[model samples]
Target: MTDIELGALLADASQAAAYFVDIHDRAALVEAANALDFTVAAANLAAADDKDALLEQIAEALQFPATFGGNWDALVDSLGDLSWLPAPGYVLLLDHCTDLRDAAPDDFATLLDILDEAASAHARAGVPFWALLPVTSPDA
Candidate 1:
């Protein structure tokens, strides 16, 4: 989707959800989220072929608190309660995840599940939380 389209979709807290985006549209995605006053954060998973690396990259990207425990529960907790990086909304860009998705499909699926859970939580609280995953192919 175009940035304008993305911005429009992101404006609705109740409709917030995870989405697959064109990898080439990274800049536009960030700009769109920023335009909507969303706290945009990105996790580059290019080098993250395993769950440990995935968690590390996400923690670093989102600037999780020092208390972060570096685990799935910690990720869910942090993503659900992003009080440290407060904003009107949130947009997480998970970039270049194809490798991880291929090398560790289970972990990738779990990550998506956690993200969806967080999105649902935010939606219930009347806040927008979008997770944008950039993939090389439409089928990805």
Candidate 2:
């Protein structure tokens, strides 16, 4: 399905599913982040009192059609020491990964690896995790 359609589906999905939408572009990302009340406070990543809250806040702020550079370590680190969702399933959308493919291919791959690890960890604990990655033609 198209990103728009996928987004619509996620919006209508039950809370049992963890949903995330990754986008490209800093301004658009900021706009999306704002829309969802997510504060782009990467500066305080290590000190984030609640990563889930941050994710929820950022999810609420996210908008599509934006591009982002992949920060593999940062993204992976963000997932560290986090609690799992209190549901049977979780969904995540890693947007703009394709954009980072050229400039930061290694980081991009590392980010995917981290995402996979997160999914595996959730699954091992009996929770389901899903992730979505968006790519533009120019991205490839």
Candidate 3:
């Protein structure tokens, strides 16, 4: 479950949950996710009798916002849809965001808040937002 894969999955799920958008359509979300310079990492999401193999997926998907159409609020709104699900178990993997805090603290903070809201909404709706954000060491 590389960051890129995480982002794509997030986008796909968000699109479906909120806008009823089809993840299979050819669009910028998919294109930009594929175009980004991503890291290759192996990660997996497990389900009984259905193991999801995310090996070799790019880690750049975390930056999907950089390739989308809208402002931060709009982005938040789109993602916020996850909160409405009956039991949405969405996870976001931020692979290498060591610099995100320093490089763009305000933006990152806003992102955190928005995500927090979504998580809260999900919780209230009896849904769970499972997330992971692994960062490389500063020395790395």
Candidate 4:
């Protein structure tokens, strides 16, 4: 999607949710989020083959507090409450997730569920929280 289109889609809190996009669109996605004053965070999951590594990458990317519990619950909690990263909205880019998705499908599915819940929570509070997964192809 073009930066303008991305910006428009991200501007609406109610419509915010997890989405898969072309890997090449990463830059445009970040630019769009930044243009809308949203906090943009990118987590490189290239080496996150396990749940622990995945959580670690995400915590680091979003700057989770030291108190973060490093678990699925903690992830949902942190994502739902982004007071530390306060902004008009949030955009998280999950980069290079193909390997993880293929290696541990269950973990990836759980992550998506948590992300969806977080997005729903944010939407209810009128804050956009988008999780964008960049894949090499449409089927990825």
Clashing pairs in 1: none
* Error at 63, model 4, angstroms: 0.4
The global C-alpha lDDT for each of the candidates, from Candidate 1 onward, is 0.88, 0.40, 0.40, 0.92
Worst 10 residues of 2 by lDDT: 61-70
Q: In candidate 4, which residue pairs get closer than 3 Å at backbone N, Cα or C atoms, i.e. clash?
A: none
Please write out the lDDT profile of model 4 over residues 12-99, one tens digit for every residue: 9899988888888888888889999999999999999999999999999999999999999999899988899999999999999989
Better of 2 and 3 by TM-score: 3
Best by lDDT: 4
Q: Considering lDDT, which of the candidate structures 1 and 4 is the better prediction for this target?
A: 4
lDDT-superior candidate, 1 or 3: 1
Q: For candidate 3, lDDT tens digit of each residue in 15-127?
A: 32211122232243334333442222212222111111111111223233334344555555555563222232554543334355455566556656665676566556554
| Candidate 4: residue 18 Cα off by (Å) | 1.1
Compute each candidate's TM-score over C-alphas.
0.93, 0.42, 0.45, 0.96
Model 2 bad stretches (over 4 Å): 1-85, 136-140
Ten-residue stretch with the least lDDT total in model 3:
47-56
lDDT tens digits, residues 48-127, model 2? Answer: 23434333333332321122122344445444323322333444444434434455555445545676776566556654
Model 1 lDDT per residue over 56-115, tens place = 999998899999998999999999999999898999888888889889999999999999
lDDT of 3: 0.40
